[model samples]
Target: MCPRCRGEALLWARVPYGWTNREGGRVEGRSGVVLCPACDARAPGAAALITWFHVHGRADDEDEEFVRLLVRWATGVSVPPLDEHAPEAENERWQRGDL
Candidate 1:
């Protein structure tokens, strides 16, 4: 679920950014991307994290935790933590439409 819109089908992407020379030479860097299919909201690049923190963070400590969770989710290394106050089973509940 997306933190901003509570959308169920949150999408992750790696968009590219950076400089391109006059001759069309390019230097690209990857951006973190999260898209809310339900709302058509887009969170892209480092700005994504900033937006997430601004919209979802409850305390200073939550900032790092959110980032870590997002990274894990985006990398497919692990599932992202749901609401900090909710138990891990909340994700299961969400999938079961019990949340």
Candidate 2:
């Protein structure tokens, strides 16, 4: 089970390093050491970038975007963490204006 989220066993998921959100704005993906969904309680960096950049190892020539992300993450740089919780989505909150 995940130690961070503490739910299902951390599945091998494919998360992007960075991408353009629905609004066409660029989103930055951190390559720094991230908290493991599990095992961190037992040890830090346990996940060892289990699933951050390039899932299958390295990026291919055809997928130029992957190559870029791979290099960006491989630089061995760690950025400060954002501990704040994400704000609720506008639609998720029902407002009186909706009537």
Candidate 3:
């Protein structure tokens, strides 16, 4: 249902690199904060997204795409592109286990 242990792998791999709070870490200007171990494992994806942003000149674009991919991975449903004025129905369905 969840891509065969993807969530477990992400969480377990990320837990160690995660900081309990944002105040004490070396401030790298990265928007999505993750633990070093998880970052290392997922570096390729992260780098690809960064490259996409660099070419497109839209920083938020990569974050938005990442969230959509995460949702699809977690819930096994394709989410429609988000709009600022509307709530995301797919998210609701995901929470309700309808997907």
Instruction: List CA RMSD, all candidates.
Output: 16.6, 13.4, 16.4
Steric clashes per prediction: 0, 0, 1
Which ranges in model 3 have alpha carbons more than 4 Å from their true place? 1-42, 61-66, 69-99
* Candidate 3 TM-score, C-alpha based: 0.22
**Which of 1 and 3 is ahead in lDDT?**
1
Task: Give the alpha carbon lDDT tens digit for every residue of 1-99 in model 2.
Answer: 544466544233233356566698978764434333344433423334445332555435477665454444344334444333333344445453542
Winner by TM-score between candidate 3 and candidate 1: 1
Candidate 1 wrongly placed segments (more than 4 Å): 19-27, 41-99
- Which structure among the candidates has the greatest lDDT? 1
- Ranking the candidates on lDDT from highest down gives 1, 2, 3
C-alpha lDDT of all candidate models, in order: 0.52, 0.44, 0.37
Model 1, residue 53: distance off in Å is 28
Off by over 4 Å in 2: 1-16, 31-85, 89-99
Candidate 2 residue pairs in backbone clash: none
For 1-99, candidate 3 gives per-residue lDDT tens digits of 123433322221111122223455542221222212233334434444434434654334247775553333333222233243345777788789987
